[model samples]
Target: DQQVKQNSPSLSVQEGRISILNCDYTNSMFDYFLWYKKYPAEGPTFLISISSIKDKNEDGRFTVFLNKSAKHLSLHIVPSQPGDSAVYFCAASHGGYQKVTFGTGTKLQVIP
Candidate 1:
């Protein structure tokens, strides 16, 4: 069973607008969460991450939030740029295990 799911396969937003991607999980044992950004034909780059101990984490233009009670997480990008157009994957891990189960992918298209 897929532990994590991103309902929307893709999202399109204009430059200077906000982009939000949502994900849900069924595993309650997951304590560490991560988000990765990927470009075409390239490997995913670590973007932001949060631990189950905290509710939110932010770095520069990217922010991620985790709600343990709901087994949900989200990523927010403000003032999205054309370069931000890429796939975003949400992942989770536990017990020092780094095997991250990725979502199908969320293709964020930032229009200029």
Candidate 2:
């Protein structure tokens, strides 16, 4: 079972266009959510996160929204740039557990 699912393996968008990535979770115990952006061979950099208590979080050109009731989440990037081409991973954790489960990741390509 894919406890965490990122259905899309990749996405391509034109420069300055909007990019949207989707994720889903099956575990009901997850209470913390995080989105990490990664470049090839580099560590993932924290983008944005929202606890189960909140519905959304935004920073700079990135925004993440979570819906606890629906067990779904999404990431949106505005005015996408070529530099934004990278892999995005969705992760979740059960508050009491130290381990976090991650999605397979989605690769976003921004064409200039």
Candidate 3:
């Protein structure tokens, strides 16, 4: 069973709009949640992240929200641009160890 899951396989949004991606997890020990953006044939790059201690974290146009009780998290991209088009993966890990679980991924397409 996958500990992390991204229900949406893909999402489309117009340039300069908002894009929202959802994720869910089953592990209660997950203390850190992260969102990574990957381009075709390229390695995933870190995006926003949230700690279990906080309900939300934001950086520039990216924001991550975590709901511990619900074991849910979501990523919001404001004013989405074409450059933001990519596959986004949701990941989680408990502190200390290097074991990390990742969600399948959600492909976001920003149309001009």
TM-score of each: 0.96, 0.94, 0.96
Report backbone clashes per prediction. Answer: 0, 0, 0
Candidate 3 structure quality by residue, lDDT tens digits, 1-112:
9999999999999999999999999989899999999999999899988989999999999999998999999999999999999999999999935677899999999999
Per-model lDDT: 0.92, 0.93, 0.94
Model 2 TM-score relative to the real fold: 0.94
Clash number for model 2? 0
Q: Candidate 3, overall lDDT?
A: 0.94
- Model 1 error, position 88 (Å): 0.4
TM match of model 1 to true structure: 0.96
The reply for model 3, stretches above 4 Å from the true place, is none
Per-residue lDDT over 1-112 for candidate 1, one digit per residue giving the tens place of the 0 to 100 score: 9899999999999999999999999989888999999998999999999999999999999999998999999999997999999999998888656688787789999999
Which scores higher on lDDT, 2 or 3? 3
